[model samples]
Structure formats: C-alpha cells, structure tokens
Target: MPRILIAILLSCALSWPGIAQAWGPLGHRLVARLAEPRLTPQARAEIDRLLAIEQASSLADIANWADDLRANDPDLGRRSARWHFINIGEHDCAYDVAHACPNGDCVVEAIRIQADILADRTRPDAERLQALKFVVHFVGDVHQPLHAGYARDRGGNTVQVNLHGKGTNLHSLWDSRLLASARLGEDAYEARLRLDPDPLPAGTDPYTPGAPAVWAEQSCRIALAPGVYPPRSRIDDDYLLQHRPTVERQVQLAGARLAELLNIVLATEVSR
Candidate 1:
C-alpha cells in the first residue's frame, strides 16, 4: 500500500534471486540434516553460541587468529597460504587451491593448527570457536566435488555453468545450489536447525593423514574429475539428474563428518 512498503517488498523479492543463488535447495537439505542427530551436547552449545552472536564472522576471523598467533609466537601458528578463492580471475588464489595436497598444503596445515589449538586450553575460547567454525566450513567445502577439483581450472572457477537460467561458475554452483533448492525460508530453516547431531567418532583425528581432506578430495575427484577442464560447463537439469544423487550423498556425509569433528573437539566441554 505505502510507497516505502512497496519498495521494501520489491527489494525483498529481488533479493530472493541472489539468496537462491547462494543457498539453493540442496544446500538447505544438507544444513537441515546437519542440525540434527550428530552434534554432541557441547558441540551444539558452541554452535548455539555462534548462532547467538548478533553478527556473522567472516572466514577472515579464522585466518587472522592464526596470523595473530604467528605474530605473537611464531612457533604457535606456523601455517600459511598464498590466496583463497579461485587461483585465477584476480581473486585470492589461495581459495582456488582446494584443500589438495602438494599445491594446496594449507588445508592440511589448517587441520594441524586446529588440533594444536584444541589441545591448548590456554587459547581463548573466541579463537577456538573461530577455528572450529573454519574446520566446519572448510570440511564442508572440501566435500564439494568442485572444491577439490581441477588445479588449472581453479577448482571449477574457470568453468561456466547456467543455473536456473543465469550464468554462474562451477564453484558458486556447489557453494549454494543445493541449499537454494531446499527452499526452506530463513525462519523455517533456522527453526529446523535448532537441533544438533551427536558427536565426532572416537579416535578419529582429522589432523592425521588420510583424514577429512583426503577423504573429501578422493570423493570429489571421483564425482567431478571428468569435468575439471576449461569452459567449466553449465550445470543444469540434465547435469542435476546425473549428479544429484552423488551431491546429496556428499552433503549428507559432510554434515555427519562435521558433527563428528565437533564432537571430538568439544568432548570435555560436553562431558562437563
């Protein structure tokens, strides 16, 4: 009715497209599953604390904490990375290096750093939490077939794909495509995610070799290796038909694995 109201409504409607782009239906499916059955009591509490924070902290918080650790005591945080995002396109090349071995060594380094952080009770809870979130998010990313995909293609960035009509990159497709498809509006989405899963598997240390990253990379290579070259093909209905099942499986596995890792780190807190 009111002009301002109309503008607001229009803006909201317009924003949905972007929202859909970032958190597609499949992504929602994964998150919905994530918020259930796996997180231990402690992990859930930490997740709640994170959710309660009024503002969302970007990945920068995780990276910078390590930087500060390195600055304060070089031996404390020896991890380093050159860039993030696709290696090409003038963006942070570090992001492009999918937690892969040899070239993208930081991913493994991150796991070790996290292990170290968890072992030291002296570390600030805030920093610990930030690092934990990085582990959670990065683990999820690594599971994405494209995340551990081609080096030359910048892990699918060089590939162009059409998503629901608009042109998008392969990396963005995996980032948000599934969540967007779920169509669980924010309120409903958050409401459903109120619950957390059990805990991490016992004696399952992700920092060790052949852990989360290795597993994720192995899976991604299987699913996305064929399409890792240039011209990053557009992902559409046909592609979805063939790969949707694998995508769902990976998303489910990622959520479960993430819960497991949280459980391990928060064992003492949960037990207490």
Candidate 2:
C-alpha cells in the first residue's frame, strides 16, 4: 500500500469511536502483571536490563504503552494503528498470510516482527525495548477474540449492542463490559484468576514457534462461537455468564505465553 493510502485508511480506522475498546488498559496490564512472576530468571534479568533503559519497573508498566501511542505520540501511532489486530474471521479463523496479515501489518505478524527485533542482541537497547513493548501489547490483543475476528464488523467494533441499557459495540462488550462486570479491581481479579485450576497450559510447549498465528486462530474461533453474538441488540446477564470465562482464560494464556516467549527470546538473543 502506498504511504498516503495507508495513512488515510489508518486514519479512518483509528477515528472509529471505541475501535480501541478491545482489552482496555486494565486487561493489558492484567496480562503483563500475570506474566511477571511467571518469567524465567534469565528472561526476567534481560527484561530488567531493558526496562532500566526506560526507568521502568515491570512489564505491566509498558503493557498499555502501545495503545496510548495515538494520544501520546501521534505520528508513530498512526503508522502502527493496524498492528494491534487482524481480520482472520473472513478465513474461518485460519490465518492466510496474504489475506489475514497482508503487508505484515496485523497483530500476528507484528508479534513475530517485534519478537525478532527483541531477540537480536545486536540491536540497540532502545530498539529492542520498543520491540519488547510491542510484543507484550500485541500478544494481549491477539488473545482478544475479536482482534482476529472476521472483517465484517471490523472485529466487532461496528456491531452495536446494549448492556444494562447502555449502548455499546461487541468490541467494547468484551474489551471492557464483560471483564468489568466482575466488580473487582485488577489486583483482586488477578487473585481470582490465579485460583483457576488450569491457569497455564499443561504438557504443551510455551515457546511454540507458531505462537501469534496460533493464538489468533484460537481467539477467532471463540469469537465465532454460536451465540457469541447476542440474538438481539440488548445483552443480558446470560451473556456475561456465557463469555466471561472465555475472557478470563484468554488473559491467563496471554500472560503465560508472553512469559514463555520472553524466556526463549531473551535466552536466544545473539551473543553480546
């Protein structure tokens, strides 16, 4: 795509009200926070080295940095707006690189690209640090089902619905409403999540080479589940009861996978 057209398309996409409603800061932070304690020692050390460059404390501190770029740094944000999600729904949740991740702008590819940059020790700390932030944020995004949903509704941003009589879109429904309905603060929510019997994948490779695409496929399937879209415009308690577990599980997995990805990425960094 030409630079001007890319800019115009992204401008319209970003201009959509609540297009960002997916995985609010709390959701992003929750993923990063969950991964902190799970990181391998080596990964933690490397992460610390990078975080120091920014005077940051933990991955959670930079979790939402990507999402905030449009407001905090307009130029880069405009260039990166499309990096957060993909339209795999058109392909039945199966990723077709040409169709789903064209031009390598979507979240799945973004994760890989950023991870590569992060894993290259030859790269400057500033470059790797930004890549680390992108990987963290994009991982959280891909796990949000709609981020990989069909393109019909722009990953549900255009699918209007109601919760408690308030108007919102499906993207926001999952992004904030369903997660927020629990009525617990993020720390409290973390406590509840840690209690899950299956908090992390068992007997599976955390550092799977097919990560971001695989994650996106799983999420797209969830978004395509029967009745995921409410039968009517008004959403009800049953909607929350049905999908909240899915939301929570995705968050947990994102964190788990992030820790694993970091452990491997940093461990395999090019020799200093």
What are the candidates' C-alpha RMSDs? 11.0, 4.5
Model 1's TM-score against the true structure: 0.58
lDDT of each: 0.49, 0.86
lDDT of 2 at 269: 37
Q: Per-residue CA lDDT of candidate 1, range 145-236, in tens?
A: 65444556555554577767788766666666544555666556444444433233434534343365454445545435454332445555
User: Runs in model 1 with CA error above 4 Å?
Assistant: 1-36, 45-105, 163-165, 178-210, 223-235, 270-272
Q: What's the C-alpha lDDT at position 197 in model 2? A: 66
Q: Which lDDT tens digits does candidate 2 get at residues 18-94? A: 37645898899999998888777778888998999989999999999988887899888878888989888878889
**Winning candidate number (TM-score):** 2
